[model samples]
Target: MAGKFIVIEGLEGAGKTTAINTVARVLNQHQICDLQFTREPGGTPIAEALRNIIKNGLDNEPLTNKAELLMLYAARIQLVENVIKPALKIGKWVIGDRHDLSTQAYQGGGRELDRIFIETLQTQVLGNFKPDLTLYLDISPELGLKRARSRGQLDRIEQQSLAFFERIRQRYLELAERDNTIVTIDAAKSIAEVTAQIETTLNAWLTN
Candidate 1:
């Protein structure tokens, strides 16, 4: 049987790492031991390089929105082809920190890119490939930013204006509303509460 592909997505500081760990532990309890972890814009050497360039500004010229979108897709495809597909083919479940939804929310909403262009690229590059399930942690931009800033200096994408993140959040909600495969969680809750919710969701999914 083909292994499942599960993705966790959220804004920066949404505790995605912690949630991922919790999900792994819960899955382990269910005897789902063969698992592979991956993150978008990374997971492979070349993809990691692209991640660095995308997260940090270049020295001379500002990166254009189109260039940023292309870079993100390039990194994503690299990870998906080299890491995700291979792991799944070997019968190991793949859990990702982020996936295609990030592009829809960030580029389509934050950068104000055309939705048709994004959809077209997704179709051309990915075909019908998609996660079996996506857990989306929803958080207010202010709280999310506050948590992110507490970690350290903000990255290029993290330094965007509040309006930008608001748009991203809106886009995320819109996408979630349209996709039944995506389950939204209120990330503003306490860590324990969030973990409990994740556990419940994962358990239900595993059994179903």
Candidate 2:
């Protein structure tokens, strides 16, 4: 059987890192070992370079919306082709910190880009490829930003207005509602509560 691709998605400060670790443990308990963990726009050297550009705003001028979208896709394509696909081919499960859904939520919704255009890009680049399961940790923008700020100085994307993240949150909900593979998790609760919920959800998914 082909290896499964599981993606964990959310805005900054949604505890995706912790959730990913929990997911690896849960999957191992289910005998799904040989997992490869990856994050976008990274997982490979080229992708990491792109990620720095996306996050740091190191460019002399502000990145255009279209340019930013293309760069994200470029990074994703590199990671998928070079790292994720190769690992999965060898029967290794891939656990991704974020995926294309992020582009839909952040760039399409938060940046106010046209959804249809974004969908077209996805189709062209990914073709029917998608994660077998996605866990979306949902949290309000204000609370999420508060947590993110506590970590350190915010990056370029992380520094977006509260209204931008609110739109991203709305888009994520809308997409999750339409997709059966996407499971929404309430991330406002305590860490223990969130971990328990994630474990339960993963167990149920494995059972099914």
Candidate 3:
């Protein structure tokens, strides 16, 4: 059987790292150990470069919304072609920190970009490529950002207004509702509770 792709997605501080660890533990418990880890706008030299520019502006030049969106797709394609696809072809399960869904939520919804343009670019760049399972850690912008701030300085995207994150969360929930592959977890719960939820959900999916 071919390897599966699992992605963890959420706002700035929705405990994605913890969720990913849980997923890995569950997969390992199932005796599925071969894994390839990746992060969007990264996982390759070219994609990493794009990720830097996307996270931090260059030479104080203002990056336009459309340009940012285009760069994201470019980096995504690079990671997909150079890393993700090859790993999956070799039967290595890929655990992704983020994927196309981030762009859909952050850029399309948070940045208020045109849905048609983003969808067209998605088609042109990724085609049918997507994660087999996506775990969305749902949390309010206020709480999420508060937690993010505790970690340290915020990145460019993280520095966005609360309203921005609200839009992103709304978009994430909207998308997750229609997609059976996406499982939303209440991130405001205790860490133990969140871990239990992830374990239960992933174990059920793995068994099915």
What is candidate 2's lDDT per residue for 1-208, written digit by digit as tens?
6688999999899999999999999999989989999999998999999899998867478889999999999999999999888888889999999999999999989999999999999999999989999999999999899999999899999988999999999999999999999999999999999999999999998998
TM-score of each: 0.98, 0.98, 0.99
List CA RMSD, all candidates: 0.7, 0.8, 0.6
Which runs of model 3 end up more than 4 angstroms from their true locations?
none
Better of 1 and 3 by lDDT: 3
- Clashing pairs for model 3 are none
Candidate 3, residues 20-76: lDDT per residue as tens digits? 999999999999999999998798999999999999989999999999999999999
Error of 3 at 155 (Å): 0.9
**What total of clashing residue pairs does each candidate reach?**
0, 0, 0
Residue range with the least summed lDDT across 10 consecutive positions in model 1: 52-61
TM-score for candidate 2, please give it. 0.98
